[model samples]
Every structure is written in structure tokens, then in C-alpha cells.
Target: MKRLLLFILLSVFCLSLPLSAKAEGLRFGVPPWPGVTVKSEVVCQILEAMGYKTSQLEIGPPIIYKGLTTDDVDAFLAGWIPQQNEMFLPLKEKKAIDVVAINVDEAGTSLCVPTYVWEAGVRSIADLAAHAEKFDSTIYSIEIGSGMQVSTEDMIANNVAGLGGWNQISSTTPVMLSAVQERIRGKKWVVFHGWQPHWMNFQLDMKYLEGVPGTEKLVSNSVVYTVVSNDFAKRYPQPYAFLKKFYVSGAVQSEWINDFGFKKIAPEKVASDWIVANLDTVGEWLEGVTAADGSAGIDAVRSRFAN
Candidate 1:
């Protein structure tokens, strides 16, 4: 009788273990940028629909690549090219991570001014120095360690576009955007780091400044990729295949950001609504993939959207 009780106790202990312990799921690392946040949400929601458990870690770029290298995170969807080339190149050389797919193409980053400011004859980086006093000899940019900040520093050091004495105001994204909005309202001259796949492109009447001879690379077009750990694909073939097939246009991503960032909607709801409206896109992403329960991935995702 005691032996029978011991067997039943052991069975209960095994049953009490968490589902995650039994089935390892994907862990996605997301930066603070809205576009990346929404992209991560869309992928996580789709994975959940396909019966795979997923989680997102809010990490910054400097540490995210390291996280991927150390296998602390499984994947990231905001690997912006050329702009992030410095951080990604070494990892690529070492085969530490894989560029699984180009999640967003035709994306670019540059200094942008309000349409009125552009109309005021400050349409290029070279034009900035001429009106230095008007712009307070300062350019607004996000956090100190960002690539934009680094490029701005180089521009100052090299006197590129005659901006040798110009200063860069470093702050968070929301603070920078708020400052831009205030300056726009006052018809003031302001230049700040701007990128596609963000609501600011739609919310503000802005134009990217033309790159000058020495500063052109700072404003070049960039492709955002989905990057995964080296062993992620081999360990989880279905999720890897689904991610490989995933793609979203810059316009579509901007809409998602506008909804989540400006309209105050939840990320999961935005992702779900997008999936419902664009089932064909989701179907394509899930082609040749199956759910955790071995059911058709497209069908599972479609059924979730239907309900």
C-alpha cells in the first residue's frame, strides 16, 4: 500500500511541472522602437496561434546582438542593415547568427526636417550650416549610444557639410518626437533622426535631407532583417520556416506603429486585427509549416482570426 502511494505521488509531481519545461518555445528580443515592437508582436501572436509558446524580451541594440551570440535570446526582427553593419558584421563572420529573412525592405534612415523647414531652403545636410543660428546649431537624436548619434558625432568631428560646430541633442524617442512636434507647431527649424516603418513618417510632414558628398552614407537606404541564433533553425524547423517566409512592407508596418503608438491600441490587438484583415499574407508566411499539434499552420491561424 505504501509503494502504491509513492507511485501516485511521483505521478502528481510530474504532472505539476510547467508546460514550458516540457516544450521549449521561442524567445524573441525586441528593441524599444515601435516598428520592431509591433513586428515582434505580430510574429509572437502568429506563433501562439500555431500552438507554439513565445515570449519577448525588451532589450536594446547594444545588448541584443550579444544576447543572440550568447544564446540568451532566440531571435530578433529589427536587424537594420548598413546602419547596424558594425554590430552585425562580426557575428556574421563568426557564423554566430543567421539573417533569416528581410522582414522589411525599402526602409531608410536619415535626418529629416518639417516640410516647412524644407521649404525654408534647408533641404539638405549641406544647407544646415548656413542656418546654424536658426537651428540653434543642434540636431536632435535618440539616446546617446545610437548609431545616429555616432554618425552625428562623426559629422561634427570631420566638419562634414560644414556642421563641425553643430551639437546633437540626445534623448529618448518620445521626447525627441515631442520636441519635433513642438518645433513644427511654432514653424521652427529642427532636424532630427528619422526612419521609415514608423508613425512619425505619416504623422509629421517631414522630408529626409539629401546626403552630401562626405555624409551620404549616413542617410542611405537600409533593409531590416529577421535574425535568429545559429542553431534556432535546426532546433525548431517549423517556426524557422514560418519566419523565413514572413515579410511586411514599410507602409504596412507604419500603419501598425500608428495604431499602437499613436492610437493607443494594444500590440496584440493590432497584430490580431492585421492578421484578420490580411489573411492571405499570413497564409503565405505559414506555407509548408505546421502547428505544434501537427495541424496545418495556416488553417490554425486562420481559425483564430475567424473567431
Candidate 2:
């Protein structure tokens, strides 16, 4: 009968809706950063323990923001303030995404120099101009069109802190770090972009600059937040609840970076090992959270990782 046919078609249509809309699983936008790599992995493992399936879209920040707006990605764990505000703020104003939580504490990104350079009176942005010859009037940064690159270019183009006419070198993270490392080996004066909760902070003996005229945006973003799509909560409240509870300290993130970035350990293994080592924090994150199967979130996680 026609009525039967209509019912079946409607059922199929409902079933074909996005699994995320039904809160079946979650998609995470993962940018190519070491701290986020392990951080996302740890969250994925915790969610898996709660019986939820998870996927990661390995992409850049711009694309990730686009995906979030389009409902293609449900969550992003690496929304750095000020640096990402160019792309994030507009969406936030439009209510396209929600800045959920500040996952990492004591976090920041800014230009820094070798300890020797800092010891030689190059402690602040103003001092860099005095020793322009030592640094060759060059500022090193990472990635073309990246947030840090954009900010550095602004500093030079607008002549902030006497940076006008200073050459800005931009490249991939690894390449830029290699050049910085080479300069450090020779103890040559070099200034490069750096951030906390990253291996570079530990590996390199350097100092984060302060007292820059136009560095309020750069130096003030000392914490990173979790960003989720607008519908992420209403559509997937279960996962959203767990995500809201997620938080990590700067020291913990740096340890994760060391294992995943410097030691080259697989992020999955690193996440699992950290979970096993820090059940107390895991329990804290699971407070008032529920698993996919409707069980207590903390209990589910503990049971899964009991081994």
C-alpha cells in the first residue's frame, strides 16, 4: 500500500541522518601540532573507553574552523587565543562555534631568544632593535599564512617596536626549528617564535619576551580553549558533556609533547600510558559525565583501562 511505502521511506530518511546528529560518534579537528596530537589522542581513548566511536580530521586551523562551521567537525581541542582569534572570533560572534573550556593552563605563544641573548640585554621587544645587527635584523617564524606569521608580519609592516625593515623568515615548524637550533649551537643571536606546553620550551634554553608595544595579542593568550560546533551540544550532549570536563595542565602537556615530539613515541601509546599513569585526573574529567551506553563515565573509563 502507498501508506506502507511512505512509512518505510520516512524511516530510511531518519536513519540516514548524520550519526553525529544522533550523538553516535564525534569527529575531532586535529591540527599538526605536537601538543594537540597527544591531547586529542588521550581524549579519543577516554571516549572510546566510554563506548563512543571517534574520528580525527587531520587538517590545519583554517580548514578546521571551516569544517566546524559547516558541521563537518564536532570538536576542536586547539583553539589558541589571539593567534586564532582572527578566524575564531567571527564565528564566535555569529554563534557558529562555542569556546568551551581552557584545556591547558599557563600556556602562551611569543617570540623568544636564546638565554645568551636574553643575558646580553635583549630581554624585551624594545631591546631587539638595539641588537639588530646581532640578529641580522631578521625575525624567524613558522608557516606561511599561519597565525604567528600573520602577527609577526603585522609587527614588521606596521613598524611595531621598531621592527620595520626587519626581514621575516617563515617556513614549516621543523625547518624553522632546525635553523633556530643551528643558530643556538653557534651561540649566534637568534630570535624565533616559541610557545609553552611544547617540546621547544624544554629543549631550548630561551626566554619569552615581554614589554613589547604591540605584543598584547601575542603575550596575553596564556591559555588554550576547546571549540565545538554550535549544534555540538544540543545534538551530541553526551560527548559534549565529557569534552566540557576535559582539562590538562601545562606541565602535563609538555610531558606529552616530550614523549610524542622529542621521543617520537606513537601518540596512541603515549595517550594510553598517560591515562594509566594518571587515573586521578582522568577521574576528575569524568565527573558528572556519562558513557555512551548510559553508564557512569568515570566507572566506564576505569573499567576499560583497568588492565
For model 1, residues 121-232, the per-residue Cα lDDT tens digits are: 9888889999999998988876554566667778889999899988877655666787789888998889999988789987999999999877655688999889999999
| lDDT per model vs. reference | 0.82, 0.81
Tens-place lDDT digits, model 2, residues 1-307? 5633443344333323343443336888876678888999999999899988988776667777887988788899988887877888899999888888889877888889999889988888888888889999988776555577778888888888898999877655655777789899998999988988889988999998885768766656566899998888897787788788889889999999988888889999999999988888898888888887889988988897878
Which candidate number maximizes TM-score?
Answer: 1
Model 1's C-alpha root-mean-square deviation from the true structure amounts to: 12.5
Task: Name the candidate that leads on lDDT.
Answer: 1
Off by over 4 Å in 2: 1-25
